[model samples]
Target: MIQKQLYFNNNMRQLIKSCKLGRDWKKNRNFHSYKAVQEDAKILVQPMHDSETRELSFKKNSNVLIQDGLLRFHSKDIKNNF
Candidate 1:
């Protein structure tokens, strides 16, 4: 087994690791001006879905839809609107 000494504690190391990854994470700010702003197109833009599965797709929450470069969805009060 290989043992390594970490400079930072577990939580500090995790925070720095997340910060390093965050540098590469970019948000699409020009979403409103997107040419094809359809749900299907939005889904295609992000390869976060499984190609084999025909599910509409979702993020952490089931009722939430992450599209148009934004997190959109109805609140519990307006959920019945759909």
Candidate 2:
């Protein structure tokens, strides 16, 4: 449980900071097939709705705050930004 929260917290912090800087995050890129994609910076992350706290990475550069497992976002469409 601690590890889970730690991962969540760490990712959350990254997300918030990225939002402030105007970055977009990506998750599950299957980089094995595309080596070039690995060079991209990570920007945002969230637990995919279908998973049990597994992260679905995102790419958005802006300030986002997550409190008590809830997120406050500034972007409209994160996928487009990535």
Candidate 3:
């Protein structure tokens, strides 16, 4: 009876250790997955930010060009009149 009790205790300890190890492995796996998702999100957002900046830059350059053209045109008209 004591031998049987010792065997039961040993099995229970093994089971508890396995359970704890499984939980730790699962937690580590989940943490890596979360980090991968965060990296992917950053990669996805970076291109959108770059495109938005480029679009804004293009618009500003276009406005500057248009204003320059208008100024030149007015200046030519004034020189011709004088």
Candidate 4:
């Protein structure tokens, strides 16, 4: 395996190395209507799209749905929410 070296002992570098890199809304900022806004789209959009399985949106800590019409449910236990 190829090893990568870190240039600085920072929090961001640590997160990236762990394969758990994510955006922190508190530190980063963006512009709004002629001014800087406190609202962050990353809070809702980025993590929700990236972390879960493809082509589906689920609520916080919710179970993955299994429909009787889908083939994927045949292999999976329908009772299990995850």
Candidate 1 regions with alpha-carbon error over 4 angstroms? 1-62, 77-82
- The TM-score between candidate 2 and the true structure equals 0.28
lDDT of 4 at 64: 20
Best by lDDT: 2
Q: Which stretches of candidate 2 lie over 4 Å from their true place?
A: 1-49, 52-61, 77-82
Per-model TM-score versus the true fold: 0.18, 0.28, 0.11, 0.15
**Residues 1-82, model 2: lDDT tens digits:** 2122223423432221112111333323443111113223233334323222222233433334444444433343123332
Q: What is the lDDT of residue 23 in candidate 2?
A: 32
Candidate order by decreasing TM-score: 2, 1, 4, 3
Residue clash pairs of candidate 1? none
User: Pairs clashing in candidate 3?
Assistant: none
Q: Across residues 1-82, which tens digit of lDDT does each residue of candidate 4 receive?
A: 1122223332111011112111321222222111112222111111221343312222222222112211111212122222
Best by TM-score: 2
The parts of candidate 4 lying over 4 Å away from their true place are 1-54, 70-82
Model 3 stretches astray by more than 4 angstroms = 1-28, 34-44, 48-82
